[model samples]
Target: MQMNDQRDINAPRAEVWAALLSADVLKECVPGAQEVTGSPEEGFEATVVQKVGPVKATFKGQVSLTDMVEGESLTLSGEGKGGAAGFAKGEAKVRLEDIPDGTRLIYDVEAKVGGKLAQLGSRLIDGFAKKMADQFFENFQSVVEGPADEGSEVAEAEGTDEASKKKGWFGRLKG
Candidate 1:
């Protein structure tokens, strides 16, 4: 499947570019991402658990950044193995532009599946891929823009632990 989208983020292009290269930020934005580690120069290794239609699987993958043009644009490519469930691979071409509001983040993505995942039909796979991409960008925007609600500050003032803060973050994302 293939898709393209764009979002205007309320932050500087440099900040957005830095966040794109941060594993911690990527881990938080990705749905079901349990862990993400590595540097931009080498690559990143990730573990993600996901459900598509009737199949659920844990995917182990490696993502690499290439053709980076400083704070402007870059290409991201990754592949994951899900054992019996199937394998998934994709590439995303991302570009950043300076906008009066902040920064405009644009992306074009193409993905493919094999094994059992390929049997799920293009419609289902396409829908799932679109949802995932949307969710990731939404999450990234939220993170870059800071807390979405005043309750987060209240929680922090109330001395909420790190775990509680994370839980609240996820709750807000879902809501």
Candidate 2:
């Protein structure tokens, strides 16, 4: 699957770049992510749990940034395994541009799945991927922007309740 989109963050380009590289921010923003370790200089290892259609998976992965142009753009690539569930590997090219309002983050991602996850069909996987990406960006925006403003554009951009929806029906059932 592939995804390309952009989001405006209410922060300077440098600050947004710093936050994107922070392990703490990554752990908090990445959907279903449980932990993140290591640094941008080397690589980061992460563990995440996600539910897709009827499957629930815990994935352990390693991610590294390449083709970097500090504060401008970089390529992130990673691979993860979910035991009997499946495996996923992908690469994303992320770029930051200065906008009058703030920094605009543009990203293009290509990903593939295998094993049981592949059996779930492309439509389901694509939907799940899109949802996860939206959640990640929304979370990142909130974190970078700091505390909420009742009537701010950030608050009104997307409803909090919708963003917090259950990952999948199977996840609710399992819980």
Candidate 3:
């Protein structure tokens, strides 16, 4: 499957680029991501849990950044195995452009699934994929913008930790 999207963040392009490369930010933004280790330069290893339709599984994967052009753009590629549930592999090309409001993050992704996951209908998988992507971006945007008030700051900090513990993975195919 293929997906493309763009979002405007209320932050400078440099700040958005830094956040994208930060393991801490990725851990918080990626849906269902339980743990993320390593850095952009060294690559990252993560464990994620996800449920699509009737299939639910845990995936361990490695993602590496390639074709980087400083703060402008980069490509991330990775693959994961979910035992009997299935396997997924994909790459995403992310581009950051300066916008009047802040930064516009545009991403194009291509992904494939195998094993049991391949047996599901395309419509089901597509819907699930879209939903996962939406959730990921929404969480990411919230993290980038941060809390608007001091009182909410404390709550946001505590909530991020709790949310990470409860969530599972970015998506079946996202690396």
Poorest stretch of ten by lDDT in candidate 3: 164-173
lDDT of 2 at 146: 67
Clashes of 3: 4
**Sliding window of 10 residues with minimal summed lDDT for model 2:** 165-174
Candidate 2 C-alpha lDDT tens digits along 1-175: 9999999987788878887787888888889999999899998999999998999999999999899899999988989999999998888899999999989999998889999999999999998888887788888888777654444444447655534322322223335
TM-score of each: 0.85, 0.84, 0.82
Off by over 4 Å in 1: 149-175
Task: Tell how far residue 113 is off in model 3, in angstroms.
Answer: 0.8
Candidate No. with top TM-score: 1
lDDT, candidate 2, residue 20? Answer: 76
Candidate 1 achieves a global lDDT of 0.89
List candidate 3 stretches off by more than 4 Å: 150-175
Whole-model Cα lDDT of every candidate shown, in order: 0.89, 0.84, 0.79
What lDDT tens digits, residue by residue, belong to model 1 across residues 124-156? 999999999999999999887666556767777
Error of 2 at 75 (Å): 1.1
Please give the lDDT score for candidate 3: 0.79
